[model samples]
Target: MTGPSKKTERETFAAYCCDEATIDLLKAAAPSRGWSENMVFSGGIAGAVRALGAMPCPEFLIVDLSDSEDPRADVQALAEVCEEGTVVLTIGALNDVGLYRDLLHAGVHDYLVKPLAVDVIKAAMHSAEEAMNAVEEVEEEGPASEGKTIFFIGVRGGMGTSTLAANTAWLSANGGESTALLDLDFHFSSSAIQFDLEPGRGLLDALDNPNRVDGLFLDRAVVKPSEKLSILCTEAAIGVVPRPAEGALEHLVDTMANTYRNVVVDMPRHMVPEQPEVLNTATDIVLITDLSLSSARDCIRLKAYLKTCAPAASVHVVLNKLGAVPAEVEEKDFANSIETEINARVPFDAKAMLLAVQQGTVIADHTKSGKVTAGMKAVNSLFTSGSENADGQKPSWVNKLLQRKAS
Candidate 1:
């Protein structure tokens, strides 16, 4: 049997069954789920094998094996005629345990023993939809070379979240890994100003139409200040914020996470509620704050939120601009409020930072060796290293956080 070509654009759903009863059931339930019932036909496994040989296989396929003398052999034969990525369901008369296991082993997505109930068919349809969605996620994420998606957010505004995020992305790329800096804020972007590059409309285009977000789409939106680093940032009009496209940020980050070794997101606090899924996908969460009482309280709030949404990712509480604010809350008290020790502390250096801004460059790049850069280097190292405890064992990220608290 000739297999369906991968190059052909496949239809959404189709079914071939031995009896009119099954076809009628699919026709009734299919339209409710936005599937076309016209694709439903009568003929069973032989029909599927015959029709798919000439046409492309659909994303979801169901075939009847009720009339087959040898179901296992027929399924194996059917696999030869379908292309990869086709999710198949089999309906048969027999309910033997061995037969169910054999059909699944032969790559059937699900098996239904007739007569099929309405709810059971609908449930199977939902499961197949989830399966198709999962396949799409994997395809969008690209190769098996998994990349880390790291998010940096401030406990309160003007706490240097973007500064730390941009520098971390730069430092990560300086180490020779492919890195992407994703500024999620459409208005008042800080990364472009820091990197000395103009913002592009590619992010707006991608957010507006997720279907157009691919490597080329990203290439158009991103600007590379260094060979290994790619940055996507924009400054939209102050009062205008467009509605977020469904699954746009998810698809974009998934594509970038697989495409690069690291993705550093400069996430505004508003996005925590707007796109919580972005936080959920992060491999690392960096919470930037100062030593003030407000910072301490919000650090507690943001850390608690991160646990609910991203338990798998490590939560890092960074004390930025240490000693900058007079009458600042004591370090021990701030740590007590959050119930977690500061993972790293970046001391304040106004003159050096202003000098770098004057030169339109990163402080770490301008002043290669300083106490400020030293603290930054420590934070950057932890950002790339992930949730590894000092014991060299990979433990639960929560446990690692608790260990930091206990220590």
Candidate 2:
């Protein structure tokens, strides 16, 4: 009921051109790819240059170069201010093969002749997305390695799963690792609000069009509140039912793993088609629950489910709101009832948590010495420890190789 009926005005894709014909084609084709007509602007390369001077560049930029006498030079100038991973597509009046080859060599995603057909434009856009994704995949995976994915799911509602996930993710990012916090609850997600960020449509776009889940698409969707931390979340209308394209979750997870050193997913308890695959792909899973009997019963059922669905993943059970435990149940008894050991117990600090929520910050940021912060740190330490070798050191060879590559 709290969700908005219309999509937010965040630009995922943009086109800057003067030609009515090309703009018309793009306007017609945008919706098919989950883009809006408002995303298109009319100023050509000059307009893009002026706009980017004041704001962050979009993930994909389509510019008209048919009017320019020096197309390559104009592109070079545009590239100077563009973000590192932005995919650029150019539309020119000429159809010369030499010109196309020159543009491609200069890192233009693709060059199209004027009087563009809708299908041709769509095909070029797809090619650009795929090409950029392929390059990023190679860069992230290389000979060294892939990233780590940690998933957090609650046993029931109001268990503080999102809180823990957000704090841990912030800590990891602040510790110098490139981290991404992804909230998969499309309709009702508070991850963005928790971090004082405005939610974007990245997750919903990926779900609606799985094939578009690539490095360029992520660049458009992810909101970076800091240099190291990226957040992907959405607050959609309650009337909207998400029907993710097949393999959407898997593709999104794979892309995230390649892009960041640490990936945190705050998953909803309600099952979706991609839930099982996401759980299976996680390197670690944290299950948060309270001390109540209903929570224990749900935890037991979820643990059993994980055993069958994600046997290889390490599951950590966190008991939240520990101070609220009834007199009838002790920690040991609660653990026994749930059939899983309590990896961490977070004491309830109602005042501190409330202050944090009101300030739009995490517990660690609000109070450095609170029980909740301490418990979250302990849980995070487990992940840090698990990342190391048995002797608590990363392999020397891997470090040396990375050093040499950096040099």
Candidate 3:
């Protein structure tokens, strides 16, 4: 099958890999090789085929056949939809020489096995570049331009949503990323207090008049506890209803996105008019709940609400306070009951958690090792690795942190 004639332009590259590791390797290796920002990363071969079938193919394409039943046939299917002069690279789990030869003969530019090192992937990309014979410099997009907002909400009150959000943002900041923690609780927020910071008037001012919320105003409004961390919160008077201007939350989140590498929003349990807008702007949503049947039921309802409100945002359910869970509901049963997998479970640590709250700090700062810390580390890994696999495998960084705590 032939596609339209190739328009003369700088060659672009796109990839649909089976896992996050390969995607990370590609993102790290792309920039030094002059690949343009027109890159697309999706899930495996099926996603690549579906996405590219409707659009003009890039000069270079990479797809994974690791999960394919017939690798050769999959490549052949991809070739049928690919335009002429496109260099297709395949990565798979199969390491057989025959399979490599078959893929090469089926119009695949190259085939590499899984467990590939960065250097190997870079070499494969370079080969594709050489095959295309198209090289040009492309502008680099900074992290701020691609900043992501993560929303954390409790499935029920007292689920420790603020704690998770605070620590996640803290970890992001300490991990060398500029991070912001926005507390949207309005009246009763503890995010700022958790960081040992006083509530600032910036959030209230922004909510009152979103039209005046520019980058400069945001910069001045946030409280910087560290070089990379900023907090935007308010302790508004109780009984005072907050009527944020129509676009106030969006404007604030947008401005924060443009300024920080990561933004963590702590959403209140009660749904406000701005809740939908905040969820819609988030790249991820962390719904915190306990292991109780009531929390699980509430989680299902909240998950449905998120699906309807912010369909694009990825939602992860974190089961907190696991120590108090009765024997009547097991984790598996709880997940089944909610119709969603429990991404991370934080064992209840009443003493440590209470101390942290009393001291206006996070558990990580209060206790170095325990079930709670381990769970928090695992939760942080989900964001750092940017993997939706939810396999509950702690990242290497988390392991290092635990090792230090043990020592």
Candidate 4:
């Protein structure tokens, strides 16, 4: 969000073979999303690509045949010129369903009408990646490869939400899971900071040119924390506001859901409009809190509200800062108060937490089998367990209790 411009690791490039008007729009939109290099060849689609012999075949390609006198021939020739793995996106002048269907049937990844934007491009790349991954998975083993989307939300301020989210991504990535840590807490987001990365350009710039959002933009925006874990964060809190475009939060969650085996969101506490999108889509929503009275109340309110807004998402409440002695409020009482299971009770370790925060490390990484690390392992187990219900709704009593308290 409004962060500094991030460089791409993969040298993601794009080829835009379109007419003058489309070329101009694409040129203006490409750089804001931090597209590494975009080449616009203004000529008939077939001839322009044929000239290259796939010289600069991109991970993704966009072509506009809006003004072509022979639309069918132009499309066929463009398809013929594309390399085997290159994904082609076509922007057509027609709004006819038949035309759209035909293009899709002819091996086009996606078909957009005139006046395309970068978001469309990004969405197409995500789709292509998903399709390719699916094929790869099928080839490697079978069609049963499990995909997971997890959202980690801090029940209150400074409960180590960002750290846990980052570690979860690392765990998944290092364990051969494709993981993404998405930080949407605009002003005070910390995913990049924890990894010691300077705020770089990311989602904010992409929103400026939503139509041009693509895999290249994503590659440019995300910074690799490790070989396995990649982070997308709000750039440093600049003077400009750091808010996602309308429905952008939803789009982001949806895209992450499709691409990675594990999607971890470092969510803001305030349940804004897009909160539902992430919570509703998550395989499990982990609400982290401490064993304080305030935290318990907040957790209760969160569970209740979630029941209303995202009935299908399972809410797993975790009590952080658990010490040797039990919390003043008994665990059973806490669970009864919230009307849900207490997924984890992460122990308190002043030294571990302080060291981890000061050093910007996860508790699991900084310490051995201490109390804190053990609790973290327990939390990890909850994720692996089959008890989680991705589509289960909370009981109505949970909502009624929260409403009464609100009144």
Candidate 5:
């Protein structure tokens, strides 16, 4: 008999205050571990408080601050509405340190600045769930943990590629993946700033001494965001530095893949000579694009370019900034024009994304909605299928040849 699906034991989440669009985004990210989410869209802060007060607070709480200028007052008001066990996560516009510190003091479990992704949000939620489960397990058993590596990239620039990559990496690593997000964009890279990280000595160091590369070297190179994730971010000081040699890049990736299952690489779009090496080695590559003519054209160019360079690498295209209203460029037409399939179309969730960047958290941490989480999972699912061949598939000719030789 087959085993039960991983999803069956997953917990549920409740959103006290959330926008319809963000709620949808959160819901999309829910199914990876079989999480089912229920959302209540109360228009504003007061509405959320009333709705939440009426019902038992779910495992997580997501609040939107778009309607208010004073986050302190909003959070204070929200505090009155929440129960002790409900982990409060705020979503908003500001990124001030003072505001974040104040919210933490006010009992906010976490804070996510807006324009968030489903995976980031889910990662946050999972962090809390994991912590709680760990507490329960410690009483019955002992310390338990596992790790994974997740990769994020921009299919095209100005599509919020760095932001999404950083947030997702932060969530998974910080949330529970013990994740490391590598910023591969040589120029104009923003992964460092997104998570308030500064890359002092990093990938460059590892590249310089490829043979010396090891966990100790990486620990020295990467910035630990939370116990869950590390940031191998780009340096803020700008200059066209020498890129790593193909062999060095490969060695670094192989080390990370062997060390952690959840390594996220935010790739540069310039198609450098070594690009294919990075692409081919990754567990998955997320190509971020918007539904615009220029973006579509660029996507097509990229697809054509990749076919020439790394034809065997698995690639998934994500339609970023998909609008609530039917867009002028239909998803089908865009897919056809790009000559690539659309893996996931993230709604234009500006508030959630912005909040996430500012708060230095992923969307999944703040909202429990499965819709947004599902979108991220769709992207993640591309990589989840192990490297083994599917059942009854044809054996490689190389394998057959080896068998005949043995015979």
Candidate 6:
């Protein structure tokens, strides 16, 4: 099959076809479309891959997937080699609606059934040119806000850490700050389920390949419950949990924080000592606990650990499910033990919480003025607008000062 010659100059349009008819149609349309006739090649997806891999991808590209073994996977491979705004259209032999939708979801500009018509090719190219122009306009606007990371860690299990984290992200996003809820629990995460969404796949790949994670990967991997809120979580099968390689988790968080205005991490407390490196750049670390003697001890242990690993992070305490059961310990006593005051206390509102859980929503949405809802709002306000931690406590500054004096 004929293929593209090694050309040093970048082309505005390029086409790779498997048949003589398709090649002739593209060549005929090239002059009118301001494309070089030599850019049209008689090789299919394979030749497109070889040529594009060597040269910069054209502004508009058409590849014949008529011979592609797995078109969706092939398109994804093309995405890896292509720059951010390279508009791609796939011409295939099959006219299946399922494949069409799958290709769109995989980020192809459009899919065209190949019979080789100039009008059809030109129309698709026009739309693609518009799409590329739109991307350029957006890039001209400015970069997105590089946001802050807020980690919600429960001192012990059954402390509503996930709920608090999800609600905090929801409030932040709904209040017009685009937010990302990153649930680090590989298996048994409820962040997506609680929002009535299926947990997105590919979080494992993202963690393992942080350097490769980008907007395209996030668009496919994260579940967006609303325009502003996105959730990245996974329910991996029961197996040996993959610990993020050294700085992998941190890199992923940094990437996400660069995209959204706030990143609320639903951190499993077990990961505190296990993956402490991920806490490196956290702006705030809110510790959730109950009024129990054991939880109080765990809070102390966690506080000590945070001081070592994330000393720059300002820490806050949250007492949830107050009065759910008899007083194991007084709230004041629990706070005193941890050497911090309770930032937010969400009392046990069984009716409201049950309604929210059953309806797959936050308690604030179900019972707007209920005590529990108010408590959740209070938790959201912790990082609503601040550089320091909640309640005017700026321990991060203290840590910086102490470091300076030590030097």
Whole-structure CA lDDT of model 5: 0.59
TM-score of each: 0.62, 0.61, 0.59, 0.63, 0.54, 0.61
Instruction: List lDDT for all candidates, in order.
Output: 0.77, 0.73, 0.72, 0.62, 0.59, 0.76
Better of 3 and 5 by lDDT: 3
**Candidate with best TM-score:** 4
Kindly list the per-residue Cα lDDT of model 3 for residues 190-298, writing each as its tens digit.
8888867898899999889664454456778999878889999998899998887666676677657645668999888686334676677777889898777787778
TM-score for candidate 4, residues paired by index: 0.63
Top candidate, metric lDDT: 1
Give the range where candidate 5 is weakest over 10 consecutive residues by summed lDDT. Answer: 1-10
- Candidate 1 has its poorest 10 consecutive residues by lDDT at 392-401
Residue pairs with backbone overlap in model 6: none
Which portions of model 5 miss their true places by more than 4 Å?
1-151, 174-176, 272-274, 324-328, 370-374, 385-407
Off by over 4 Å in 6: 1-146, 388-407
Candidate 1, residues 1-407, lDDT tens digits: the string is 22233446798888888898998998887887799888788878988888887888788998999999998767766776776667787898896645654454344665778888887788778767766775566466544223467899998987888988888888888876679999998998889789788988888887887644545557668989888899988888989986767666766776566456689999999889888866766888989988888887888888888888888788888888776777477888878878998899898899889988998888888888898899899998885553333443223212322333456
Q: Better model by lDDT, 1 or 3?
A: 1
Candidates 2 and 3, the one with greater TM-score: 2
Give per-model CA RMSD: 13.2, 15.0, 16.6, 12.7, 23.1, 12.7
Query: How would you encode candidate 4's per-residue C-alpha lDDT over 56-80 as one tens digit per residue?
Result: 4455566666667776556666644
- For model 6, residues 1-407, the per-residue Cα lDDT tens digits are 55555567656788888888888888887777677888888678877888788887777888999988887667666665665556777898997655764554344666778675787677666666765664555456444332468999998889889988988888888776679999998999999987889997768888776534544556678998899899999998888677665456765776565456689999998888889877875979999988889988998988999999999888999888888878798877877888888888888888887898899887766677878888889988877654533322212212332333466
Q: List the pairs of residues colliding in candidate 3.
A: none
Q: Which stretches of candidate 3 lie over 4 Å from their true place?
A: 1-146, 272-274, 325-328, 354-360, 387-407
> What digit string (tens of lDDT, one per residue) describes model 2 on residues 62-91?
889877778866776676556655777888
What value does the lDDT take at residue 213 in candidate 5?
Answer: 57
Provide the global lDDT of candidate 6 against the true structure: 0.76
Off by over 4 Å in 2: 1-146, 272-274, 325-328, 389-407
lDDT of candidate 4 at residue 28, scale 0 to 100: 65
